[model samples]
Target: MSGVQDQLEIKFRLTDGSDIGPKSFPAATSVATLKESILAQWPKEKVSGPMTVKDVKLISAGKILENNRTVGECRSPLCDIPGGVTTMHVVVQPPALEKGIGIVQDIAQTI
Candidate 1:
């Protein structure tokens, strides 16, 4: 019974309004760990899903969860509801293109 209280039921709501899970994670799990899990379970058929954990962001209770924060620490009062599954929005923003890749440099002495 005590162990059950230590688990958090979370569902990842994707941009398309589809959900990935209502999975249970240990309260001690870090937000970064959740991102990894989300990346792994992301639908392969989705053309533009996150390619890495670094590209995944988890938003709960209208706030973005910090990577270093534990699930327990990120929980809001809404999460205190008994036996309710918390829904976190998943946003996949891929890393920007490498810097200086598109710039054309011309080194010519004015003549």
Candidate 2:
């Protein structure tokens, strides 16, 4: 309540043209936290949803925001219009295959 002015309205636009929120968050909130929120609210009907925060990527102003950066830090002048909600694109990247396992097996066969 004290820092209501510091609260930013954010909406996550998913790849399927669905949205997760237009919710208010403190400026100090981290990108990782936003991902966790998205994971929690992911639509049950949607297929291939992100399984963890690591699978989610937040993009704003054509830049992929780092997990360590706070929401305030990721905001750009063009995207942070006063009293306007910021829309960030959400991308879910599936975990990579385990290539190391195959490589180790090959080395063992060679030995």
Candidate 3:
């Protein structure tokens, strides 16, 4: 156990008030890694479109974490991070819908 550190447990809070989990990851894990894990374990019933890392944003301690940054980099910013499970908010921004769909609405209103 030369340089071994305790794993960090993170739980995600979604927009609908649903939570993902307190998944464990090495302290050195990157934000990108966390996003990938979420996509892999995302509830099918909740998501419909492609769930990519770009669609996921992780916020902790009121700060939006950088994808390239490590979880350890964020540890100090959060209060009692090591003392208990670190809670982060996961925001999934819906993709913009196509513009053509609006044409139907315009035609209906004209009639």
**Tens-digit lDDT track for model 2 on 20-108?**
99999999999999999999999999988998898898999999999999998988997688789999999998765336677888999
Best by lDDT: 2
**Once model 3 is optimally superposed onto the true structure by TM-score, how far is the C-alpha of residue 65 displaced, in angstroms?**
0.7
- Note the clash tally of each candidate: 0, 0, 0
Backbone clashes in model 3, listed as residue pairs: none
Candidate 2: minimum summed lDDT over ten consecutive residues — where?
94-103
Cα lDDT tens digits for candidate 3, 1-111: 524345777888877888889777888999999999888888889755336898788998888999999988877653644447888888876545324457777888999
- List the candidate 3 regions with Cα displacement exceeding 4 Å: 1-5, 48-50, 97-111
The true-structure Cα RMSD of candidate 2 reads 3.3
By TM-score: ranked, best first: 2, 1, 3
**Deviation from native of the Cα of residue 12 in model 3, angstroms:** 0.8
Q: Using alpha carbons, what is the TM-score of model 1? A: 0.83
The positional error of residue 41 in candidate 2, measured at the CA in angstroms, is 0.5
Candidate 1, residue 26: lDDT: 93
Report the lDDT of model 3 for residue 59.
Answer: 91
